[model samples]
Target: MQTEKITSLQVAQRAGVSQSAVSRVFTPGASASAKTVAKVKKAATELGYRPNMMARAMITGKSRIIGLVVAYLDNQFYPLALERLSNALQAQGYHILVFTSSNAQDRIAEVISDLLDYQVDGIITASVGMTNDLTARCETAGIPVVMFNRGQDDAAVGSVTSANVAGGRKVAEFFVSCGHKRIAHIAGWAGSSTGRDRARGFAEGLAAAGMKPLAVIDGHYDRSIAAQVTRDLMARSDPPDAIFVGNDHMAFAVLDTLRHELGLRVPQDVAVIGYDDVPLAAWPAFSLSTVRQPLNRMVDATLDMLLAQIAQGEIAPRRIEFDGPLITRGTTLTPKGPKQ
Candidate 1:
């Protein structure tokens, strides 16, 4: 059996308002008085008149949808950030279309091309890189793209990230103040800007303090790999007294391997610090000392940048970096001043 669908005109007739008023009541960011809005909504409720987003989009040239691309969700920080971003977008009367992309450039290009076909208002990519050709296509289509927790050399793209360099330096300062001479760092994926920046800063900070890392092993942001590296670092003839891991996700593995497998005591035998103070870091079992990336602030900043582009014509791309504070816990020796 076939059924007829209700139209906006019928609701307008029932509410004793014009079709234009009915349209305003249904459209987001459109203006209608309270009485008219109430009457139109009441009529719509009685008639079960649902707005067709596809038709509306055709008329207004706006889908009110932003495409979000993410490479990895393994880290707790990313999941939390995604939730915050979704909520913030919803509050602004916008919707999200999520696409998962792998680290592979070809897969990322395909996902982005699909997003463009859907006519998304904007895009936000987390931990994914875009090629110059893809960037040119997006520019030609007049779609603004913002990278979150990632960086690109292209000036046409925008990004928001914590000051990884400063965060790394802070960790080095803490280790030096705590009198740890033999320090090493289990680095994140060397390909990532966040990873490279953090490693460079840590090394420079150590050098400035008249200290050099005993070893710097690339963990590639993998738990099993980081654990294996930690074991290898321990087996060295002159083992490190302290280690700074790139992120909390891998730090847990490093901590577990050092304590359980190697039978080493934290702080007493080997101190550990990590980046991204995820909730797991606070668990009684770990009590990890780490640098805290301000997720809420980062999310807010990302949205602001995205919306500004959506409002104004695409302007010069800008990069915003927020400051992250080091949170000291049981894993590292306490410094003289109060932890930030």
Candidate 2:
């Protein structure tokens, strides 16, 4: 009453090849001659035979699946990074299972546990944090974990990040070179390493220039909160001549607050510089001056480390940092020399 499922054996018989040859043709990273592959593929096409990925994985002891956990997508950068990672992994014969977690610790833990249950070959966490217990569990499960655009104090955890501190320092130097005397900072949440490192570098840069910021407030990487902070800063009689926001997402809100609500002209009444040169920063509406995080390079490094650990059956955690350039736009003054 029901149709029978086609298998590799039937495909091999039709193609005049052994079952093992058909398997080699279908399996990822398996060796097979071009003629054999073509014959097997033709037979598979004719018979409508699709290889069972799960069964193949069982034979290899590798799911060849990566778990991607991300926190927050309001920032355009994260989505772009996710796309790059997905495409890159797919090309390397791997697929990804994505899980979204709020910045909440418990939610992230739950998602990590779910990923582990699926027996993914490795995990990549973007803008998300993991607890000691969860990290331990992952290590015990022999799963390699790589943090993308995030960092932890634990030496056992691997991470890839743009040079946040250096980028921040560059922003400060740019502000100083532009002759902005009263500078303020709307920082990302201090709890995270990216945020802390950026703040530290900005301060150090300012000190190097023999200047100090008017104020440094936490924006928590939120648009509305950044807007509110911008309002409060502008309300002061001695407001900053320039403001450095942690990232371009918040910088947009800060720009809007300055232009619409406060009736201020960018780079005239106040200058704004932000980190993460996201695509929106180049939009005609918001030509924001910001630091460019090399997303492609970062993604490449992340994949390289993740795959290497997976292949080696152990993770000797390493931190990879890439230098990012600052892109100048309409929102900030041109430096004395050639513009970046």
Candidate 3:
């Protein structure tokens, strides 16, 4: 819809003040007298003259925009997180400029430079494969960059992720305690930080109980890949009595593979578990046992960390990892005694 153009000069003329006064009133932290501010408001109201944040950004060379990089929007978790991040940033009077990468190191560098060219106040990389150089560049530019979901050990980069290793370990401990002797894994993409940490932790947890898995396969965080991986693992010389899939998304395919394709009953022939207890995990069709990452708390922490860094010009890099809870459900066999 076409709207009326409201110029600052017109506002100043109506308020009987200089144009600079109007400009100062609109700019954040700009000095303007209370009387002038009130006068500009009155004039703006009369003429429906709204200030343009984008236009002001051009003059200050500060876009107040965040660069949000996502590897694949296909994953329901990412799309859901994207929506929440966008809404949260908007509420904070900032906007997001989205970049969809193929999780490539080269492409990520290019995308980050472009976003920097636009003078974004901060950058958030949700992609699993963002390179070190890209993050270093953002650090040099004095723009805050936060790694969410996937993170690095470098303290120079602020990261917010679920305690992947701990969560994975919890799943393993639960399985072993419930008397699952023959366990297998449909692991996440081994290339990503999330996948590796979970894998390591799961193995560690199993070692504590002195029970090793029958087999483990890399799922690559893809449904088709996960299904194929599950098939191979389960078809081994001695298939596992229980299985742990990387996330809820891949777990669904594993379930289908076992029940429909392989004709195996869950928890009887093969107990199953997954991470990221997404909405569908609770659905009757899936009813999957999984680990729950406190989504709201994670989101809040990420936003708060980014905004603070942006406001302070720069911040000491830090990693903030939160724990996830193991949720027991229908896919696994509950122990006979009191809950382990």
Q: Cα RMSDs of all predictions? A: 2.4, 2.3, 3.3
Question: For residues 180-277, what per-residue lDDT tens digits would candidate 1 score against the true structure?
Answer: 98999999899899998899889989999998989998998899999999999999999999999999999999999988999999988999999999
- Across 105-203, the per-residue lDDT of candidate 3 in tens digits comes to 788888888988888999888845556677678888988888889887777788888999998899899998788888988888888898888988899
Q: Per-residue alpha-carbon lDDT of model 2 for 187-306, expressed as tens digits?
A: 988877888889989999999999988999999999999999999999999999999999999999999999999899998999999999999999989999999999999999999999
Estimate the TM-score of every prediction.
0.95, 0.96, 0.88
Better of 1 and 3 by lDDT: 1
Show model 3 residue runs off by greater than 4 Å: 1-5, 11-50, 338-340
The TM-score that candidate 2 achieves is 0.96
Candidate 1 residue 8 Cα shift, in angstroms, is 1.9
- What TM-score does model 3 achieve against the real structure? 0.88
Top-scoring candidate (lDDT): 2
